[model samples]
Target: MNISRRQMLILLPAAAVAWKSVLAGTPESSPNYKMSEHWWSMLIDISKCIGCGNCVRACQTENDVPDGYFRTWVERYHVSDENMTNPEVISPDGGKEGFPEAKEDGGKYFYVPKLCNQCADSPCTQVCPVGATFVTPDGAVLVDQTYCLGCAYCVQACPYGCRYIHPQKKVVDKCTLCYHRITKGLTTACCEACPTGARQLADLKNPNDPIHAFLKTHSVQVLKPQMATGAKVFYNDLDGSVR
Candidate 1:
């Protein structure tokens, strides 16, 4: 059908406006997301941590993590110059409550928050016989609880003591870096609760992310570099005795 130029101009603008309205009212479909384009990481400022346990509690509350187990925790490290290799580490009750007063000792004390490294070459995933535990395209290591064999192989394979078999779920569980929240463009619960800004969720693939600037200016290190799991969590001013 042919239309007059005057009629075509009026209809074209109205149709374009309606199309934009429909798009604005609808959320983007997840199937269209290309998760492979993102690589995730976390940055820990050891100097800023105060062992407040806010992060620990937030993680448990957000994930419903089991008691006497931790997807994340904090440890107080006491290192004496006389024995740098044997730093005393303590995290009573997984540090869900803050620590008590200091004891009489001549040493330096600091807090170190621990969580999943979300390793690129994670041992936990390699040891899963059923492939129940796997990494997402966005770089989170997750377990399919329905498929997990309830074996502790993933726990054993983890060098950083980050994995555990859930007592009730009967499946391997660990930190997913709050994949549910991050995918929706929100930060992790732990990072959100960290009062001192000690924890930061980072997208290494994003050039504009502040983590890129932090890395360039700071001397950062990951736990047990020798294992070479391609651990992604980075710590700033990490003590030499840290394992």
Candidate 2:
């Protein structure tokens, strides 16, 4: 069969359009395409944590956490089911000093680290009238210091009490998950400094990521599920009563 030059010319543009359409339909080319199915979340194994405080110090030095405020903190919960009145909650003056010596009291106790919950439906982002707080492409919730008014509404709305107004910058600030470091292919200071490997940062987008596998193998819980913030932080072996 002989094809004329005119017929070949007529077919070229249609072929180009078809090719373009196929490319446009792909997930990578779509404007709203998200590479990961879920946002990053952290899981802390309280049983494995020894309260070394190395994580806290690393966060301070790495992120420049201010003297009076913390980007992350830790709390100790002492529980006595036998005596409801004797239940006590304790946190060291600062995560700076790490956890105190464990007491020999006749009760069960554990230490839990706290940081920005980084909720998918974050109240801080909702209440920010100026659009200063926003989620990044990688799903990290962050506050743009330049856009912040320092109104502290975000500080007030955070359920985990993670957000705080920077005393020197006079802007709202909190754990950024060490955004700068993460973007550089490095782990957060806290994660890197954790002596026992209790704190781990995992990418939820990749199914092969350890966090996705962990979430599948174990049951995890978020803080204040009743609030429906869709918190991304996860706790393994968490006590139901402890918030």
Candidate 3:
């Protein structure tokens, strides 16, 4: 059956649109997800983190993050009894590989995973001249790489040092909480890869979500609460020495 010229024209444009969607990284929409019905967040239990670098490796692989850059990472802290306020912190290769044996024995050692806080009043969004950075209604901060100017204003404005200029793409990049996955009713790669269940994806709007119960019973804290960014990542058993 041969198609007429008018029919071919219409089919060509429709096929182009379909191909564009296939090339796009994130889906236009998920069939079952309602953005308004969910407020996404993450919960990190410091006590449960073994600093094995599973989260880091998983994030890099899932997101195709460039080498020497991280969408999510881990830092190991050593707080000596002598000086509690000034802890030694280090993240070798974004903690993609597990840390070496600790030389110092007397200090308290703990691991702290870090990512984009997905702030409610994000300074990064405020600084983006082109409005490339914005927060979704469901509480995830994302960058529209197509519109990003690569001015690095958002990178400087971020207090948590989460954003980075993509070396190849020439656009600002950061953690999206695995937007593609979360919007599809799946957990973030970091949360899924955590062996000890140290990381948990949360839906604040869900009545049955464990985050509500956990928040009530646990003494949780957000990083740099004084900044008051309304960060969604909640840390349980966080140390005072953590910056």
TM-score of structure candidate 2: 0.81
Residue pairs with backbone overlap in model 1 = none
Identify the leading candidate in terms of lDDT: 3
Location of the lowest summed lDDT over 10 successive residues in candidate 3: 23-32
Could you tell which candidate, 2 or 3, scores higher by lDDT?
3
Q: Comparing 1 and 2 by lDDT, which wins?
A: 1
lDDT of 2 by residue, 129-236 (tens): 999998776778899999999999988999888998888999999999877766655678899999887888877776777887788888788889999998888888
Scored by lDDT, model 2 comes in at 0.80
TM-score on alpha carbons, each prediction = 0.86, 0.81, 0.87
Evaluation by TM-score, superior candidate among 2 and 3: 3
Q: What is the C-alpha RMSD of each candidate to the true structure, in Å?
A: 5.4, 10.4, 8.3
Better of 1 and 2 by TM-score: 1
Query: How well does candidate 1 score on lDDT at residue 28?
Result: 50
Model 3 Cα shift for residue 235 (angstroms): 0.3
Clashes, model 3: 0
lDDT of 1 at 137: 82
